[model samples]
Target: MSNHSSSTISAFGYEIIRDHILSSVLGKHENEVLYWAGKELARKFPCRTIEELVAFFVDASWGMLELIKETKDGRTFQLTNDPALMQIGYRSFRLEAGFIAEQIQQIMGYLTECYDEKREKQQLITFTVKWDVKERIQNTIPNE
Candidate 1:
């Protein structure tokens, strides 16, 4: 199969697992479990830079991730999917948020967390990744 076709099939499978299977299996703790799972995934596939992080999301078929803003303590990112793909009812973005949090923590060497805000009307998600500069970790990803 062509790469594009393979990606489409992968994305379809991802939706099935993410929207239906995971929720059914995880039940009420679905979000929490997925959040931690994302963190674990990040550790396994670490990204050293924001560019790599953005590319990782696309390569993983998660979504189109764009860094929309940055501040002293945090960064804001927007995640959007194709309009046709937005029909899926799964509203949870916790997994993506957790992944971003962990990636940022490793990259910045600070205690970091991410919160996701769903804009259903806009069919997009906004992630606010915040870090405490004071809470630095010793082993950080070196800049490339």
Candidate 2:
């Protein structure tokens, strides 16, 4: 998971570890743990802008992340992976959601959260990210 790691893993290999191995080890707490892990990852590899965030997703082999909509209080993103990856059984996107939430929270100085909805027919996931504009965090992480 290191940003500077020279090694690369195939999509199938990534799925094996992420979907099979982690699921077996974490069981019912898989989603929750992955979410926090993703947040920690964001802290380690911070993205200063939406462009950098999208690039990070691609580099991490998470998916192609696109900002579909934006509002004063929130934003909506669409994530799509390789069609072959979609056929590889069940998958959860909570990690990606948490990553986006934490990144936005750090960038905006707000308490942000994100949730994802699977668009099965479209073979994509939609992430809705929201923040309390009225309740700002006292200490926001500065971009490095």
Candidate 3:
């Protein structure tokens, strides 16, 4: 059987933030350069495996992994609201934890819509986030 689950991007969307990040922080920095900051951010959120790390970021709504690269210096993922990589947000921290991975590409982005939905992970604490855009990226993906 084929596992066909649907998803979408909306309120608590990354539009406002992504735009700010790309314009203000990322600036004219080609997708390649900003990836510089991305690698740093990924490290902050310590994931045991790259797969977990990729899953964490995409599920974490830390923008979308538009692109990922590694030079002689380091590795990075260029995330954005690609629409192609849309997903459902967690209403609580617990729910965000047991979240599963998607079949979509590892790199995706966020959208600007407004709405809410039910949860399959009932034992999880799901909450909408208006995450502060200050700590753009961290050294590891803490258990926060």
What is the Å distance of residue 137 in model 1 from its true position?
Answer: 1.6
Off by over 4 Å in 3: 1-12, 30-33, 62-144
Candidate 3 similarity to native, TM-score: 0.33
Predicted candidate 1 versus true structure: per-residue lDDT over 1-144, tens digit per residue = 567636454556666777788889999998899889988889888998999999998887777999999999999999998755544356578889999999999988899999998888888889999999999977766433
For candidate 2, the clash count comes to 0
Q: Candidate 1: global Cα-lDDT?
A: 0.84
lDDT of 2 at 53: 96
Model 1: lDDT of residue 59: 81
lDDT of 3 by residue, 1-144 (tens): 544334545544555454444457644453444343443444354455547655665666543332244333223333343332233242211222222111111122111111112334332122222222232333222454
lDDT of all predictions: 0.84, 0.86, 0.34
TM-score of 1: 0.87
lDDT of 2 at 40: 85
Candidate 1 has which clashing residue pairs, if any? Answer: none
Of candidate 2, the 10-residue stretch with the lowest lDDT total is 83-92
